[model samples]
Target: MTKTAIIAGTGVLPGILADRLDETNTPYVIAELEGFAMENPKGRPVERFIVERLALLFDRFDDLGVEQVIFAGAVSRPAIDPERIDPKTATLLPVLLPAFQQGDDALLRAVIALFEDAGFSVVGVDSVAPELVPGEGVLTTAQPSQDDKADADRAAKVVAGIGALDVGQGAVVAQGLCLAIETLPGTAAMLRWVAEVAKTCRANPNGAKGVFFKAPKPGQERRIDLPAIGPDTVVQADAADLAGIVIEAGGVMLLDPEATIAEANSRGLFIWARTP
Candidate 1:
């Protein structure tokens, strides 16, 4: 059996993945980032690593017989300390530094390449937990009005436009008017900003507030960093006074699908796993 190394960041996802791996008796180890700690480690075997010394992590993985790697949860860019950069990581700085100047997609692709070059296969979350990616449909009891559907369509295009520049994975559109685009601050912060804005603005003529749409960037490396939402997202959207939440079916991960749907239903907000 190939042992897998899960590079966990901050969020419930790493714990959720750990739980699934446990249920199947799969051999795995959780490698926690230095600053971005896993929300719930579930008492699994864990190792800590810093980005500046990845060579040491590779060596540790070798000792643990880890042949595959997967990334779970969210991570902010770490400020590198030049003094801590190991000789091996230093050799890759030329590539990495330039990627760091680029968008997140570029940086992640570069990171993935390093692991691949070290002879490990990188896997996507969907491959390990297909159920987390909900299929196309309105998941909540509340349905999207025709206006909401149109807003979703517009939001999808806006997300794609920003994604092409490696900007973000989410957007808010109401009655074909672009309300906001998510940037590095992330979905929760973006939604909070939208809520603040809603306090002063009137609803669209059609009476639909807006749609919060999320999806992975076009041409993004889906093996890691896919857009995700959970119960909290539902609460945030409701607070923003949005009509519904729209996620690209098969692209966005639904953390705790049951709770997310339940929250949306209770808030009378629709959760549409849209097809595209």
Candidate 2:
């Protein structure tokens, strides 16, 4: 039977996408990244190397008849250690230097080329989770007020600008001001920052509450590391006592939409999709 595979980088995309394929009756395999800057579960099948080591991943793909591969997860750019690249990947070093030395975007594009050369078509996580793409409308019981929308707009611009510079794609906003942006510490930490700030705002009585906006970094590769939100985001927002959430329509992925939406509705959090 034809097969598919997931080249998991970080976060929950690898396993989530794999499960989606399974539901479609499509068999799949996962090649988790090893020794990269991100977390990896013990006993997972991971190969330690750079993008070029994908050549070997294709060997495994061929064995499973995996004609398509989805590159998912959250491996940060700085996590790659040059000394860890295997011999085959080492040889491709010269060709990759210009891009690798430049930025993660260029490096990922190079990796895409390697996979293409090996006869496997690379796609995004959206292929398996189309419903995860939010539409233009209120997605929760509550609605974003005009002021909240303004804050979300400002946060979106800031987050997208930061994404363009490869910083990150999420920002917290309240009353047209930015509270925090997702950095090396990750989104959860950033939300916590907003929560802290929200407490101060609430105490002031004249201040406004906060919300989070997650958008794609401008020019970020859609095939890899698309911004994702799930039930955890709602839980986090509730803990932060934030007012609502906004995400770019179709730009970010909802890891588990039904559960996430249900959680947001249950928590009285408003969710909207902004069009830009």
Candidate 3:
């Protein structure tokens, strides 16, 4: 039997994955991380562990017979406490600690390498739920207008530029202006900020809503950590007065397609998926 485990962090992504696994009767363990800085997790039978005790976490997983792992949800980078590291992980700290200075994509790759070196299969969330990958094209009744399409195109280029530097994967372009770029707080926060800006311009005679673009970082390992767009994501974008969302088709995951599309349509918003 293939034993799967979820190295979950904070966010709805963990819960989404958990629900899918449960619906399919897939047995799994949740290796929950400590802290609320990045994500508030939702799952059952979770074994909480700090990054410092990674080796101990492996021991617990081994006891549970967890052979394969999925890194789910967003985990922000924090200053790791070397003193908290178990003696086992400390032995490998020389190989691991350097990742702290690298960008998120590089750090994620290092983490994946750690798991693989342990004889565990590190898989992407899409590997377990391939249906979540969005298809290329407009996914809603209201497609983007020419202006919105232009903004999306600009946003895509901006996101790609930042991505190449391992900066971020999302950007908001409105009224021919780049409103905001996603930062460590993540995409939702960026949308929220954009929403605030849209409110300020609500009375502007020439004001127009915007579009949020998400794509993979340049040269980013796509097997895991691809950008995710879900129902909550649509709601955030809508709140930002974004006309629609532009995602990299085949590069992003739509966690709740039915609900997300329904919500987008209801809000008079659109979800367009384009290829990179």
Candidate 2 C-alpha lDDT tens digits along 1-276 = 567777767666666666677678887777766644334443445544445464566677787788987877777654446665777667666666677676667777877777787798888877777887877888888998877787887888889788888777898877777767888788888887766764565434455566789988787778877788889988998888788888999898888788999999999998888886
lDDT of 1 by residue, 1-276 (tens): 778899999989988988888878889999999989888735666799998999889989999899999999889889889999999888878877788787899999999999998889999998778899998898989999998899899999999999999889999898788888999888999999989974345354447788999999999999989889999999999899888999999999999999999988888999999998
> lDDT per residue, candidate 3, 1-276, as tens digits?
578888877767777777888888888887777873224344266778888888888888889898999988767776689678878988767767888888877788888888888878988878788878877899999899998888888998999889988889999888677888987788988888877764455334365677899999888888668888888898898888778999998889887788999999999898999877
Clash-forming residue pairs, model 2: 10-73, 10-74
- Please estimate how well model 3 matches the true structure, expressed as its whole-model Cα lDDT: 0.82
Model 1: pairs clashing at backbone N, Cα or C within 3 Å: none
lDDT (Cα atoms) of all candidates against the true structure: 0.89, 0.75, 0.82
If scored against the real structure, what TM-score would every candidate get?
0.96, 0.85, 0.89
Indicate the residue-level lDDT of 247 in model 1.
97
Ranking by TM-score: 1, 3, 2
Clashes of each: 0, 2, 1
Q: In candidate 3, how many Å is residue 246 off?
A: 0.6
